[model samples]
Target: MSIRHGLLALLERGPRYGYQLRTEFESRTGSTWPLNVGQVYTTVARLERDGLVVPAGEDEAGHALYAITEDGRDELRRWFTTPVDRASPPRDELAIKLAMAVGTPDVDVRAVIQAQRAHTIQAMQDYTRLKAQALEAAAARPGVFDPDDVAWQLVLDQMIFQAEAEARWLDHCETRLVRLAPQAVADRREGADNPPSDGDGTAEQADGAPQRSPARVGGLRGALRRPRR
Candidate 1:
């Protein structure tokens, strides 16, 4: 989420002070991406420097206020219209950790996947609870539509979806590892049982380095599947 563009979008509604901008942004996004007052002011300064925003006036409390400029409006419009670049998706730390864990000397790859799956499931449950609360509160309110309640519900829904996806992906990783592991073990046994031969099946590598069959040169999949003692 681009905080800069988000601030500009809020400003388009009207002139607002830095704190107000921060509050409104969080309220709309359910505080998923928090912005400190200092960060808000810093981004506001940059926007002013870029001619995307301008000082409007001071509020009754003497707080400095800003309003979006024509350029800022244009930028916000472009942001809304432009699709977020997914060609190079943001780095997922869990994905990186699991990728590095595969075949890692002493790391329990299955344990890592299971732990993450559990954590994601917990988060999904939390989000579900929050959604239920939001829905109940809205229902009690009758005809009055609360914007904040709706915003929070949407944020909870997004979090639930992401958590569900992560859980599914973890399951997929585990299944793949299980299926590939036995084949890799079989390959190793085949290679080890039948040493490389020189046509007559009586020759060695000659250099004393154990030889692996041509078909099993790079079978590291079994390494991820820890062998039972």
Candidate 2:
């Protein structure tokens, strides 16, 4: 997410070209967030512009190298010490999809949740397999120390944990929906039996058709409105 900071962090080690920095970033992160060569160069250029990095001559192979400045080091240090802000969370597509599905007519919200659960579980399993492989490699080379491997393992662990948490949250959503089903049905029936007027002394459903409001469908929509941290 913070490509600039990441680049600065890598530059702290030694001077590196755009390609080398991109490679190192992917290698350290297990390619979880891949960066193209252009992106690397773009970020480096910005850092140079901001005085966080400087164009350090060139490598022996003629590649343009970049070195971090004092300002860069200070910024990297602050980034390391500061906790990531979580007061405003990023928009989760799955959360938005589920919320919309719950309110939309003729949408099977449970099916959507189940499908996402399956996908998330599969991802978790894949991450678990990768973690096992990483551990096995580490065990085989007990006498050796590879910081890259350690970094990758940490990244994989975070992804695995996130997937597991998502699966659990999906289960909770399913259970809550099931528990509220009866009440939802009752509300729908009541709404159908007593349709609300349209303020012109005429029922909105003048044709005696049943109307399903978001609240009448399920309290799930209301539940989604509350903030969760």
Q: Estimate each model's TM-score.
A: 0.80, 0.84
Task: Give the alpha carbon lDDT tens digit for every residue of 108-154 in model 2.
Answer: 99999999999999999999999999999999998898989999999
Q: Per-residue lDDT for 107 in model 1? A: 88
Q: Note the Cα lDDT for every prediction shown.
A: 0.88, 0.90
Per lDDT, the best of the predicted structures is 2
Which runs of model 2 end up more than 4 angstroms from their true locations?
Answer: 197-229
* Cα RMSD, each candidate: 9.0, 6.0
Which regions of candidate 1 deviate over 4 angstroms? 186-229
lDDT value, candidate 1, whole model: 0.88
Candidate 1 lDDT tens digits, 27-95: 988898888999999999999999999999999999999999999999999999999865456888998
